[model samples]
Target: MGISTKEGLDIDLYQNKGRFLYKYAGSFLENAVKICFKSRFPESGSKRIENSSGVRPRMFEIDCLVGNDAIEIKWRDATTDGDHIIKEHTRLKSIASSGYKPIRIMFYYPNRSQAKKIQLALSDLYAGLGGEYYSGEAAWTYTEMRTGIDLLSILNRIANERGVS
Candidate 1:
């Protein structure tokens, strides 16, 4: 089962001039994954962990927790920077080492070919953590809470609705 929301998700909520849009994009990805969780694990007691609004340097929050699993959804595009990538890798490694089942969902545009190259470049960052890299086509399975939900389609729908080309 896949999540279906009635209202349109607005990417414009995070649109700003000359900004990386990390927070906004993170929020959007969290919400999207939460929707998938709700539908897929309706009885698993899974939910998106909420945090207080406002910018704080040390704020800690996991994207979603399902049956003792810590899942994070990342929307990686061509504009993604090295610093943010390293930060996320460190977080995932820490979470896994702490005994949580760390699952990372990496969303990329265009196709798996390009996404694979990007994934390979990040291997060193996640090295020694048994991190497995999958192409975009196979990424959904690793990050999915349940089968049959097309996450890429949901992303495309959001992009289309937001007129993001």
Candidate 2:
């Protein structure tokens, strides 16, 4: 094959595989966190609330809602798009207006400066709206404290058993 054609093929393959890996990993981690929360708070699970603001979607999803708390769980969020801030702001506002305290818990923190900035903005937004944001080690600690489950330790044990590291 020609050089350009080979390069294009390689890029396409990489993009497809990357998308699958990211989606699968994120879904798995988010579901695991929800499971932990459900074990502790039997009533907690995914929830959908009206956007009250008449947003385009007209609805926003809370990954897990326990009592009055609206939680958004993520394995990692590395989006550098400025639009993300606007969307998240709207979502949080809708949650708040619906009488729920918005919360965000992300296991991994983005390393890129732009992505870091986005996360910082989100953290501030959460605080400004009377919500909470936790990422990295703090996220792990928060999950364990709230669920009475040492998630990291359990994951480590599983990894060791599978000889992953």
Candidate 3:
């Protein structure tokens, strides 16, 4: 990191902070959703299952497991990487092989065309596997319906409290 000027150093620091903030925000949202699910389904929590697809990772983690539903929660996924679909496919298969129905809940949908295409593919993949995928408004509705929690309203309140529009 060879930054000669103060402006350059500030820019680099800002970018680094942005990246960290993105990760923290995603984790925060995911955990919040999991907590809501736990409140509704006291026995449900994260689960780790062995990858039956013989993939690189030997294990796949379900964000929240309620009954036969293996849930994967995401605040947002904007990955343009094609390999992401492959990995997700493997993970969903592993979850299904564990005698559970795979369900994806993504709170935010990416605006990029490539990312949107990826999400569409995932939705189709889930449907093909007899699973379910929910994103954006549908994800919010599903969470509220399943957990009896108004997550969007709660988030809006928190944002208002934090002086974030």
Q: Rate the local accuracy (lDDT) of all candidates.
A: 0.56, 0.91, 0.92
Q: Which candidate would rank higher by TM-score, 1 or 3?
A: 3
Candidate 2 per-residue lDDT, tens place, 82-127, comes to: 8888888889889999999999999999879999999999999999
lDDT of 1 at 52: 30
Q: Write the per-residue lDDT of candidate 3 for residues 1-165, one digit (tens) a residue.
A: 676699898999999997886788788899999999999999999999998997579898888999999989999999989889999999988888889999999999998999999999999989988999999999999999999999899989999999998
Question: TM per model?
Answer: 0.51, 0.89, 0.89
The alpha-carbon lDDT assigned to residue 28 of candidate 3 equals 88
Model 1 residue 113 CA deviation (Å) reads 13
How would you encode candidate 1's per-residue C-alpha lDDT over 62-103 as one tens digit per residue? 666666666555565443456655555556556555555655
lDDT score, residue 132, model 1? 41
Which candidate ranks first by lDDT, i.e. highest?
3
Worst 10 residues of 1 by lDDT: 48-57
Q: Which ten residues in a row are the worst by lDDT in model 3? A: 18-27
lDDT of 1: 0.56
Supply the TM-score for candidate 3: 0.89
- Give lDDT: candidate 3, residue 40: 98
Q: Report the Cα lDDT for residue 63, model 2.
A: 93
